[model samples]
Target chain A: MTLNRRAFIGTGAAMAAALAAPAVRASNHGKPRVIVIGGGAGGATAARYIAKDSKGEIDVTLIEPTRMYYTCFFSNLYIGGFRDLSSIGHSYGTLAQSGVNVAHDWATGVDREARTVTLAGGAVLPYDRLILSPGIDFVEDSVSGWDVSAQNKMPHAYKAGSQSELLKAQVEAMPEGGRFAMVAPPNPYRCPPGPYERISMVAHLLKEKNPTAKILLVDPKEKFSKQALFEEGWNRHYAGMIERIGPDFGGDNVSVNPDEMTVDIDGVVEKVDVCNVIPAQKAGRICEMAGITEGNWAPVIPHTMQSRVDENIHVLGDASNQGDMPKSGFSANSQAKVAAMAVRGALLGSNVFPAKFSNTCWSLIEENDGVKVGASYEATDEKIVSVSSFISQTGEDADLRKQTYEESIGWYSGIVSDMFG
Target chain B: MNWKHDRFWGVLATVAGVGLATPVVAEQQDARIGDAEAGKEVYDLCVGCHEVGPDAGNGIGPHLNGIFGRRAGSVEGFRYSKGLSREGRLGMDWTLETLDAYLENPKALVSDTRMSFDGLEDKADRDNVLAYLRQFSDSPQNIPESAPTGRAREVGLSQETLAIAGDPEFGEYLSNECTTCHRIDGTYDGIPGIVGWPEEDFVIAMHAYKRKIRPHPVMQMMAGRLSDEEIAALAAYFGDLE
Candidate 1:
């Protein structure tokens, strides 16, 4: 109540309100249609910002498969009980209210030459510019004995919602002293810190319900983002409960047997109570189908996010092969602003400033115990380069950790508002 | 002044009630007081870690509600770093000078702060951001000696007495140059929609470029050619847009 009261008397609208959602206009017949595929952080923000800033000058439509979009950013926190699934879920009502056409449909194909996106319903939506922010999709055959068919039993849970629920259920159902094995994905995956955060969360849940349970992380990469901080957290709270096998120790050579729920690390096979097999990932199917893939991801100019293959299309979030930025929701949100600005400028001729981007990734090791790594970036000719960066140090005091946790909470709220609204 | 403009004075009245009128220096700023409207844009740099609304809880940095002259590191529910706490105990109130210094380089000022921001380097940008923060300040603090004073009666009556006032009609007449770059209907070359902006913001931005506080050489060259009234007129015309 105090928070609401405080907000009521506070100065003008918050930054989220001030920046996007312009009051300009044009009729559909004359207005340029901007189609955004995906309703996650990147898509929603881009759609809202374009529509708002244009004030009806540019027509904007958002195509998403689901009406209730659950964010992948804090899904790990949900597994660890820091948040409920509903809290991380967002709807398109605000975007619709702000004058965006929110269409719930799968984008089946992009007729690049025709400049139209054909939806699953067979309706073709024309656009002056198309923004593809389809989040990552797991590489089908990247890991042996692991595929989408076995996802229900040995869940990847990367996309959030049902998969996340399944993984959390599996972690919860584990017996005391049981082995919970996680086959972490390789580099160029969505949310670089995500797998480790999931590990920390599962460890927290296990420590509470099954204290002696072991967390076995089979990591393909030799080093990970925030490695020191995560290592410190595991030592401090979940000490002796987690062990990581990096590439040097055959972490790269791993296979899963879903029927038996066993993970074979190199030549050694280990039976596990629960298995989370996160495979190598690539841009979503639609991105590949659209023919934007240079390989696993679409290439885009770092400044405008315009696809290198086609200037009319912009690829954002994990799907983009922009330099130096992680494929995280935070990064998506940051990139969306730049793309939105560029898109609007291209279509409506809105005043545009230089592209500026920032990202912060937070991981919760325990309740009220969190750490973060973040950076400020500028778009250079070669790539988006980091200008300044900071990371939480190992063994930080409780107050700082608590502060970091609180900050994550604040960032979550602010970013969600910036995206959904 | 119109009823819309009166709202600022009304908000200031509440602040002035508990406000301290300490003599201030524009030591870190220029002759012109920065505009809060433009400052909001610059605040984008700090948005990564700090939260700025009244509803904002402590983020990585403290929620900066009513931060001006608020005791350093004294926001309720926030855990201040040890170095920051010492600054508070040593009686460091968040004055314009303190804020300017902190924004210049947080590490140098606090030495042991746990904040992740590298700090905002430009002084003019800092002044603009501070102006933005001053709006939410529950109680007013310093009064810059250089700022307009004793113009209360004139403030609500004539544009001449207003600090950043402009005549929209005159601005419209002189807006030919703006048209080539910024189209009247909010459509132009990769340029943004300058229409419907607050006059104060437009003035501050032009001043930022004219003063070379910001980095755009083209903007600096263009802004350098204008007089204060001409800039104000242009702002008024553009502000009247949308």
Candidate 2:
């Protein structure tokens, strides 16, 4: 088990489509219906927790496009060859076993006032409570010349799975001394430490396979999560191998010409053997379609994860504009537990505990060099804020780092079991 | 210049978790203990096996309601390990000192116990967990007087690790595991609470648990895991809470 955030986001809810439909399960048990629009970390966990805890009291229906989910958290380890792709992928069979009506279909439209969801398969499902944990989506036109059409050429392995495979193949195929470039995303994105970890993983691969090869990081932000630790790791493990250009050096204003296989940074174009263009991210499009979003993300009450505009809907994970919490799988899972408790209390009249949340973000710099940052949070009148926090220092010993890495493995196993089983 | 050794030095100076090795001889500052709030967080690790509170029941492990002062191996339907049953025959109660010893090394205290957990390593963690445990009991066991002020005051229970009084808020998070056996709001089945006791009482009980004076294998193993700082923090949290 490794670290990765797996988002369960609805496909295209709010965009009505006409296709031959299968009859979606209606509320059969006279129980309140919970229609979860995604089956990844947040959605699946909420569905599982609510359904299992309710003991057949509430009906849970999970709609997801893919039967298998590839976690975005540890997909970097796959590229670094620490794990296989199969290990990062999970199925929804476990959720179904827990009595979740796992529906494999696209969520095309939503009638919020009507409290109904239209599926691409021509099914209209009604709900008493809708939990929308649609993961992130690239903000359209945020990066010039790098659209969905150009994904194959400049893969944003940020989504995991096939994209991860593609990027790995490209890295493996890079000619000796060839240049590899990355177009990093802006702040407040999924997994703040993600790109830097990817950089470390790539550097690990290149160091072993192609020592002479170089990596160029064009980062929009001047600083990043675990900057000091990452810098130290890079210097120790891959010194003189990776170079980063920050905002002051025009790293923010950048574009990739897929047609020419070049990254134009500050009026300078650099042709590379491979390129990773991670565009700006936003709340899942379904959130915007449901009219729950203010700018790019849906806002929710911290304690319950309920939408500010509509209490019937709850948003979690990357789609929700939660203060001080990262948009990672751990965060999503924690939020889901809180939401599940609140939802159970609302629907089943169960006792609801005051919302308390905690999250830890772990990143591997090398094989056994792992660093972590975590905090416990409480929902205040204004927002979810940190109560206490801890981080790995710059000059930790191998034994401690090894222990930290082991702790992450334990967390991964614990979370994966919690989410899927 | 040595990357690996620098990390080694960093570990010695770690601010959180079990032991640290920075020798500081400053002013005699008041020793604040673990936050019950933070102990709640650390208790998350134990949730999978144990259950606490009124709704709590026997899961993978026995329900930990009314644990302190309750006889060992006496959770009615729960099958106690041979060592625990033997200790129960000896009429052992869960004193804080005994709990500290048992948590520090469960297997060493009670061999062949059914529990699969590794004990806490930080003294603060053990003390905080014990404090968190105390929150569920109406009448916790009496605190031992004139106990050796735990090396935990400045150093961890372990010889190599240094200890610090942790934030109870964080301890609350760490105590997620403890809630599997002991609930936070003073509800109990087989376990007990320290929620309303003074911090000093909680600390003495934990030292008893750690020294194996009380002979429950589960407590021995669980106590073994925590450092002095963690125990101190737990005391502050559970003792200060209402």
Candidate DockQ values, in order, are 0.02, 0.02
The Cα local distance difference test for each model comes to 0.73, 0.71
Name the runs in model 2 displaced over 4 angstroms: A1-29, B1-242
lDDT leader: 1
**Per-residue lDDT of candidate 1, residues B27-99 (tens digit):** 1111123556778999898788788875777777788876765788898888889999999999998866788
Best by DockQ: 1
> Interface RMSD, all models, one decimal each?
21.9, 23.0
lDDT of 2 at A210: 96
Residue range A1-421, candidate 1, lDDT tens digits: 0011222222222211212223222234577788999999889989987988778988899999898989898999999988999999888899999899999999999998778899999998887789999998888878899999999989999999999999999889888789999999887788877898899999999988999889999988866777788898889889899999999999999988999989999989999999999999999888999998988889887757888788778999888988667788878888898798777656644433335566667788889998877654555433554433456777778987887787677567767766876
Q: Write the per-residue lDDT of candidate 2 for residues A1-421, one digit (tens) a residue.
A: 0001110001001000000011222345467788998877789889988998788898899999998899888899899989899989999888889899999998888898788999999999998789998899998877778998899999999888899999999999999999899999886788888899999999999999999999999998866777889999999999999999999999988988998999989999899999998999999888988899998889887767888878778999989986657788878888898788667656655444345566677899999998887655555333564443446789999988887776666566566766776
Sorted into a CAPRI-style docking class, model 1 comes out as: incorrect
Q: Which run of 10 residues does model 1 chain A get worst, by summed lDDT? A: A1-10
